[model samples]
Target: MVHPNTTPAQLSSILRKCAAASVLGSGKQAHRHALVSGLIPHSTLETDLLLMYARCGRLLIARQVFDRMPHRPLHSWNILLSSYAQSSLFHHSLALLHPLLASGLRPDHFTLPSLLKASAGLDHGRTGAALHALAVEMALNVHLIVSGCIVDMYLKCGWLVDARKMFEEMPEKDGVVWNAMVTGFTKAGLLAEAFNLFQKSQFEAGDADWMALPSVLSACSQSGDLRKGKEVHGRAIRCLVLESDAVLSNSLIDMYSKCGFLDASLHLFSRMRVRNLVTWSILISGYGMHGRGKEALRLYEEMRREGLEPNSVLFTSVLSSCSHSGLIDEGRAAFVSINRVYGLEPSVEHYACMVDLLGRHGRFVEALEFIGRMEMEPAGSIWGALLGACAVHQNVEVGEIAARKLFELEPGNPSNCVALCSIYERAGNWDGVAEMRRKMRDLVAVKTPGCSWIEVNGERLCFYQGDVSSPSSKLMLQALRGLLG
Candidate 1:
C-alpha cells in the first residue's frame, strides 16, 4: 500500500524500482496507487507505468496504459516499439510506425533501430531498405547506432552486398559494427571472409575485441580448422580476455570438440575456475557427437551432483548420446525422467531421439507404440528420424508409413522422397523408385547437394558434390586413394 502523502516523484521512483526488478505485481500496485492519488493525468507517472508493464512483458497492459495516456511523448512510443521488437513480435512492431506517423510524430534515431530490428527478424528486406532510406532522409544515418542496425538488418535479411556496402561506407567503425559484419559472414558459412574481416579488424583497431573472437572460433569449428581454432585461442589468451569471459571460453571448448580434439576440450574444461550449464552441455554434446555416450552420461551425472538442475537442452543432449550409442534402455529412462524426475516436459526433439533409438535397432513395433503414447502430436523431425532408421534397416513397410507422414507434414522436403526411394531400391522395387521420382518432379523438390570444407595452408576450401573444378581436386583424390590403399 502506498502512503497517503506519497508525491508523484516518490511514486515514479517506486515504479522504476518495480521495472528494474521486473516485479509486475508491485508495478501494478504502484499503478493503482497513482490512480488513487489522482495522478492519472501526470505525463511522467503515466509513462513510468507504461514502461514498468512493458519491461515486465505485460505488453497488453502497457498498450492499454499508453492508449489512456493524456499525452504520449516520443519516449513512450519508443519504449512500446522497442518492447514489441525485443519480444520478437515483428509484425506488431511494424504496425505501430503508421500510427506514429499519423500522429504527426517523425521517427528519430531511436525509433528506426527498433523498426530495423523488427524488419531483420521478419527477414523483410524491402521494409528494412525503406527504413534505411528514411534514416538517410532525416540525416540520422550518420549516427553510429543507426548505421550499425542497418548493416545488421541487411546482413540478417541475406542482403550481403548491401550490408558490405554500408559497412565499407561507415565513417567510423566500432566494435559493435565490426562484430556485426564478422558474425554475419560466419553465420552465412563464409568462414574465409569472416576470418579475413577478423584479421582486418585487428589490423585497424590494434587488437581484436573479445566479442568478435567467438564468431571466428565458431567458423573454425564449423570448418574443422583445428589450426585456426588454436590460433584464436592463443590470441584470446594474449589479449587476456579468455579468462574473464565464460561465453568465449565456451566457444573455445565447442571449437576444440568439433575439430576432433576431445582431450584438448576436456583439458580446457578442467582448468576453468567457473563453469555454467552451457559449459557442461557443450562438453556432453561433444562426447555424444564423437560416439562416447558412456563418458557423456558420466559428465551429465557429475553436472547434476554439482546442484545445477538440467534443462530441456541438456536432456536432449543426453538422449541423443544414448541414441547414438544404442543404449535404448538408458534412453527410455532418461525420457521418462524428463517429466517425472525433473518436471520438464519432453519436447519434440526428445520424442524424435527416442524414436530414432528404437527404430535404429529394428524395433518397429515398439517405436510405433511409443509414438502412439506421445503426449503431443509428432512433428516432421520425429517422422524424419523414423524414415532415416527405416532406410538403414531396409524396412519397406514402416519406411513408407514414415515417408507418407513426412510428405503430408513437410511436402517441400526432398530428403523424405529420397529416403523412401532408397528403401524401395534396397527391396528391389524398381517400380516404386520410378514412381517416387515422378512425385519428386511434380513437387519440384530438389535435394540439396552435399558439401564439405577443408583447411589447407591457412586457407579454407569448400567442395560441393561433383565439384572438380579446383586445380588440386585430382591430386587430393589420388592422395586419398593412396591413403586407402
Candidate 2:
C-alpha cells in the first residue's frame, strides 16, 4: 500500500492531512510509504512524517523515526516534543528536553507549548513554574497562543493561583486564551466561575467561537442547566459550529442527555452528518447513563457493523451499559471480547464494570472470585461497587468485608459508612447501625454537604443541603406544605 512513486511534497501533503484529521491508520500507512520511497531524511518531509505519527498517537514509531534522523533541526525536536506531549508520555517527553537544548537548537514558540504540555500532563508544579519563568524570560509568553499554554500549564499543575495570576497579567486575551481558562475552570469544578466568565466574555467579545461552547456546554451539563444549554445550542447553530465539528456535536449530545432531554440528544445524533468513534461513544454513554442498556448494546453492534473498531473506551461504555441494565450475560460477553477479540487488556475500569455487572445480579461470591482472578489490583471502585451491591441486597457479611477494604483505601470517605449503615438497617441489625455511626464519629469523618444548582432567567441559582437562609425559604416551605396538603 506504500505509494512509492509519490513525491516527497505530495507525501507531505498526505501526512499533514492525516495529522489534522487524526486518521491514525492512514497516517501509519503514509509513514510506511515515506519509508519505502527511500526518502532519506534529515529533511522537512521526514519531520512532517514524524509529526504525523506523533499526532496520530503512534509514539513508539515517532521515536523510532526521531532516532533515525541523522541531523535533526530545531523543528524536528519540537515535533518530537509535541508527539510525546500529545501521547501523554510526559516523563519520556521531559527526558528529551535537555538533550534537545544540548544540541544547540534554540527553543521557539512551538517548543514552549510542548514542554508546557508535558509539565501539565505530569502535574509537575515546580517544573511548570520554571517553564513559565523561562517563557517570560525568553519572551515566548508574548506570543498570545503560548500565553494560553502557560495558563493551561499552571492549571494542570493544580496551581490555580499561579494560573489566575498569569491570566490576569497577560497583556493580551484572545479567544484561545479565554477558552483555555474556561476549560480549566470547568475542570476544576468552578462551573459558576466558568459560566460567569463565559457570559462576560460573550458580552465583550461580540460573538462566541466553537471552542467556547464545549466548556460552557459542559458547565451547563454538569450544573443541569437545560436553559443555558439551549442558549449555547442556538449559538452553535448561528455560528454554523455544529455543521463540521464532530466533537462539539458530541458534547451537545452529552449536554442534552445529562439535562434529561433524551429526545433532543437522539435527534441531534440522528442528524449528525459524520459520526466518528467519539460520537458513537458519547451516544452510547448517554444511553447507558439513562439506564437504556439494551439500546446502548444495540448501538454498539451497529457501530461494529459499520466497520469501526471498538477501542477500550467504547468497550467500557458497552460494559457499563450492560451493568446498568442488569444484562449480566451480555456484560460478561463484552468483557471477554475486550481481551479475546480486541486484544486490548482490560483496564481497571473494565474490570470494575464486570464486577458491578456480577454484583448487581446478586452474584457476590462470583464477583469476589473474579476480583481475585484479576491481573491488576482491585481498586477502590471495584470494592465500592461490591459494597453498593451489598447494601442493595442487604448482604451484611459481604458488605462488612467490602467496607473494611474500602475504609483502608478511602479512609476519610463517609459514603462507605453510609452504605454500611444502610445495609445494617436493611438487615435488621440496629446495633450494627449504631456501631457504624459511632465509628464514623470516632474517625471524625465529616461528610461534605451536597449542593445543587438550577438555571432560571439565564442565571445559576445555587442551593445547599440544609440551607434555609435564602430569601425564598418561607415561600419554599409554604409551597412544600401546600403540595403535601
Question: Please, what is the whole-model Cα lDDT of each candidate in the order they appear?
Answer: 0.91, 0.86
- The top-ranked prediction according to lDDT is 1
Off by over 4 Å in 1: 1-65, 68-72, 87-89, 205-208, 462-482
Candidate 1, residue 406: the lDDT equals 95
Residue pairs whose backbone atoms clash in candidate 2: none
Residue-wise lDDT of candidate 2 within 94-172, one digit each (tens)?
8998898789877899998888889988888898888788888888888977888889888877788888899988887
Mind giving the per-residue lDDT tens digits that candidate 1 earns over 1-485?
Answer: 77888899999999999989999888888888888878788999988999999999999999999999878899999999999999999998999988998888889999999999999999999999999999999999999999999999999999999999999989988888898999999999998899889888886655645579999999999888888889889989988988888999999999999988999999999989899989999999899989899999999999999999899998988999888888888888999999999999899999999999999889998998999998899999999999999999999999999999999999888889999998999899999999999999998987888888766676657789888999988998999899999
Backbone collision count in every prediction?
A: 0, 0
- Cα displacement (angstroms), candidate 1, residue 192, comes to 2.2
Q: How many backbone clashes does candidate 1 have?
A: 0
